[model samples]
Structure formats: C-alpha cells, structure tokens
Target: MSAAAPTSGPATGLLAVGAYAPPNVVTNAHYAARLDTSDEWIVSRTGIRERRHAAAGETSSALGAHAVRDLLTRHPDALEGVSAVICATSSPDAMFPSTAALIAGEVGLRGAAAFDVSVACSGFLYALAVGHSLIAAGLAGRVLVVGTEVMSGTVDQEDRNTAILFGDGAGAAVLGPVPAGYGFQSFVLGADSSGGPHLYLRGSALRLPAGTEMGPYLTQNGREVFKFAVRTLGDSAEQAMREAGMSTAQIDWLVPHQANRRIIDAACERFGLPLERAVVNLDRYGNTSAASIPLALDEAVKAGRFKDGDQLLLAGFGGGLSWGAAALRWWGGAG
Candidate 1:
C-alpha cells in the first residue's frame, strides 16, 4: 500500500485519469522457449505479449509516480483543489511507509491524506470508490486515486503458469465533484473471503511471523478464479446498472479488468454490450492487477473511444474472489 494525502469533498470531481506502462516490453517469445511453453500457448491463453517490466530500480510506487507525472502534465489543474491521494496496489516497494507516500513526494502533493489499498485486482475500484465518495460526501474535494502494480516482481519468472500473465504498470484518476447524475451514480462492492485460498500467496508477514518469503510469489487456481471473475463481475456490473436505474442500452462503455479476454467477453455477453464498446489492452499489458482499469481507461480516452457525458460501467474481479462495479458519467477529458 502507498501513503497519500487526506481529502475533503470537492465539487464536480474526477477531472482526469492517466496511465503509464514501463518502457520495457517482454514478448511472449521472450519467455516461451526458455520455459516449458510456446508463444502460441501464451497468446492463445492469456492474450499477452511484451508486457512492461520495471527497470533495475523501478518499483510499483515509482511507476505510479510516472503515471501521476503524465496525469499532472495533461491535467495540471486537477490537483489544484485535490485534498487527498489514494493508491491501490497489492505490491509495494517496502511493507511500510506506503507506496502512496513515495508517489506523493514524486507528484509534489504533501497536504492530502495518503494511504494504500491492498484489495488485489479490485484494489483500483476500491480506491476509486473511496475517492469518489470522499468528494461526493464532502469529506474530500478532489482525490488522486491510482492503481499500480509491478507484478513482474512477484511472478516466478520460471513458472509459466503465473509468469506469462502479469506485467508492471500504473493508472490514475483524479476524482472531484460533479452535478448529481454527472459523476458516479451507483457502485456495488462485495467480497467472499472463503475464496481466498484459490488466489493467495503463502509466507507473508501480514499473516505470519518472522517473514522470510512473504509474497515473494503468488499462488492461484486459474480455472476457479476465472469462473468467479466471469459470473461475479457480470452480476456486479448488471446490479450496478440496475441500482443506478440504467440498462445496458444506456451504457456507452464497459472498462473491465484486463485479466482475461475470455472473461471480459463473457461479461459483455451477459450484459448485452457490443464487443466494439469495450477497450481491451490485454494483448499489450497482460494483467496489471489493480492498474488494469486505469490503464484501459487511459488508452480508451487517448484512442477517442468516449465523449462528454457518456455512460460507463467500470467493473473488476480478482483475488479474495472480490468483485465490484460502478456506473459513471464519462463527462470530459482530453486524454
């Protein structure tokens, strides 16, 4: 988790979202022959390629700072009224001090409340909700909510199962206040700790004493996690739309977690959303854990896939078997 500043409700929030993928790219072929896999196997299964890895000294917080750097450049004014910073991530440079703290220093934001969120893949959404609520509740003005991950550090490079599906990256969104019906309208968050084992890392200090290999690696059951992702993510999205008094017809975009192309397709099928309405970057970045959504959002905006006041449904599913969804009005943005 990272440390950031505190916020106190702002008017018309979420002024911008920015993303950054490290310059380095590791193609499937780069990992295939060395391991017991092939390029074909990698692409057919995970739709990944050339995922970006951090340079020698790069860390999750560092990459997140890069994203914030670009964000501030494009939206220099978004931080003007910001009151806090919230970073969503499962991995941090160090266990303490919070990655948000380092990122805050990088971005020159020292007055807001800062903290890190550790909700696995749903971390970004968790952070986004917090920022949005703080503004909507008058608790914080504008908030810097970011999701970043350097999964390359956790994936056993030799383990084809996990190594082939992760990449390092960061994405951020600055949330402020907006007129009623102009910002986030409805959101659904749920967790089933029982499914924790299906996707957890053993030997972590957080759950044990005298940590030696705490989270040095990740353990997961792909099949089970995929099933949960498909069903729960779809259900949560639909539930959010309904709660917001909306239907699929009103949704202009579905920015989903870039964990799997298949799971995303399934969710869209269940929601009756056209395939063209989505913005998929899995082929380029793999699963960036919490950073997936922000990365996708940044790309979509850059690619000119949205417009002012467009309806968007953001959803995610991940470890903890947790899932969440939020309905938003993609009001304005140049990038």
Candidate 2:
C-alpha cells in the first residue's frame, strides 16, 4: 500500500512527539548471568548493551499514556482538537477493549475514536499513515498516533534469541495540519506472509509451519529476519522517496527501526546513506518493536538535530514480514 500526495489544502504533519522507557534497566550483564553469553558476545553481534524492562503491572497502555502526557507537557495545546487515537502494538494488554481505547481513557480522550494497528515494528508507520489520511480527508482535526510495546511480557526469559534483543517502551506523535509543502510527502508499505515463520510471537490462532508448535513466547529465525529486514528497509525507503520525487541527497536523516545495529548499517549502505546519517539508539534501548522509530525520532527532536524544512525518511520492518517507509518534511521549530 502507498499514500499519494495529500489533498490540496493544509497538510498533516507531526505537531509534537514524545517517548517513555521503563526505569528498570536490564544490562547485558544481567542477561549474561542467566544466559550462556557474555556482554562482549552480545554487543559485538547486536550492539545492544542494555534495554529497559517494564516493572510489574506496567502495561502497554500505561506506557503510551505516559508518552502522550509527556507530549502534552511539552506542547500543551498539541491535542486540543484531537478526535482520534491510533495505537500500534503487537503486545497489547489484552485482546479486547483495544490498547488505543485503554490509552484514550488513561489520557482522558473521552469522545475520541480509538483503534489499534498490529503490524509489529512496522506498525508505527502504518498508524501514522492512517492518522495522516484522517486529517487529509477532513474526518479529523487532529489525531494522536502511538506505538507502544511491553515486549518483555511476551519474550521467553529462557530463550536468548529474543530475550537479548527486545525492550519495553512507548513513543507518540500528535498529527495535525501544517503549512503547505511541510508535512508528510508519501508512505509506502508492504508485506510477505510467506516470511511469517522468520519472526513472530506464537499464538494458537495462527497456522504453524508444519512441525512448529504454538506457544506464549516470541520465536525467531534471527539470521533469516536480519536478511529480510536489511533488504526491505532500504527498498521501502527508496520507494517512498521516489514517490515523493526525492533523491537520496535531499534526505537529512534516516530514522530506521532500532532492530539491530548491523541491520541498520546494512540498510543504510544499501540506500547509499552513510551510517552516521542514521538516528540510532539500540545500544541504550534494544528494539522496542513498534516504538523504535518514534523513540529515535523523539530523541533527535529533543536534541534539536532537525531544522524546519529538513527532509526525513522513516523506515521499519518486522513480523508479518512487513515493512513501511515514509518521506516527511519537518515543520516545527521546537522539539
């Protein structure tokens, strides 16, 4: 799927962004003590030194609400006319009542329409596209897009494959009208169901790949997923940029999903972008699933790395063997 240029009129762009990570830090040392691995081995392979684990009772909605509150505090009027809330996650607090609905209640969005997007790491971009469309279609004045995950809740502590690679966190953005030529340009998304066996959380409802059995934990073929992500991330970003009538030199930053340092490096190389041009934080916070891109975006925004009119390319690839990329022109002066 892909989005065309917005309808003629005001453009929809991110008004404000926010993120939150649980205080409980789980360092590589912590994993080393339990798993048959050392910090050097983990860091050299995944470039993750530590990750945040939500404390007991901290759910996805709670984390998302905190991120929304943080955004409100920074941009006090960002949500004044917000009419919808979109949450993207694979680790919802429950299967019913939707995480978006739960977050709306937590944040007092009493009458807002609420829903969820469950495309794993690519979910944030998917949610952003929907929010942008809602505003462009005049169905909403503003929309709050949130990506939150309590991945630790679904990870098997005994399994080193996923345990050392995931963390818990939330990131959010308030989408509303912006001046012409300074908002989202295009969004490109795609999926390959045949690759589902490469990375996924086991569930009874999903058909297994022959001998595979379902369980309550995340399972992955790390090598296979790494290959898929490296190719998909770059391909999606290029398609989005082309759709936006842009070239690589016009993009200022590449905010990619914080899955693995190697994957980011590979994707950047394939996209003809220097590694330093990419925003990364996986060393401090391993992949937070859907929250990865926004978390990195919020951090960069806070650091004042982006200036008005700067171009940005956001890309993500994960379970569902799905991928999404978007081209955006920054509008805000403040973080």
lDDT of 2 by residue, 57-80 (tens): 999999999999988888988888
CA lDDT, every prediction? 0.82, 0.89
TM-score of each: 0.92, 0.96
Off by over 4 Å in 2: 1-9, 204-206
Q: How close is candidate 1 to the true structure, as a TM-score?
A: 0.92
Superposed by TM-score, candidate 1 places the C-alpha of residue 76 at a distance from the truth, in angstroms, of 1.4
**What is residue 290's positional error in candidate 2, in angstroms?**
0.5
lDDT per residue as tens, model 1, 1-335: 11112222343446787889999999998887699998888877777765888898789988999898878778888778777889999888876788988788888888678899888899998888777777767778778998999898887889889998999999988887665547777767888877887887653446722322456688778998988888888888888888778787788899999998998888788878898888799999999999999999999887878888898998998877688788887777544
TM-score of model 2 relative to the true fold?
Answer: 0.96
| Worst 10-residue lDDT window, candidate 2 | 1-10
| Cα error, candidate 2, residue 160 (Å) | 1.0
Q: Among all windows of ten consecutive residues in candidate 1, which has the lowest summed lDDT? A: 1-10
| Residue 228, model 1: Cα distance from true site in angstroms | 0.7
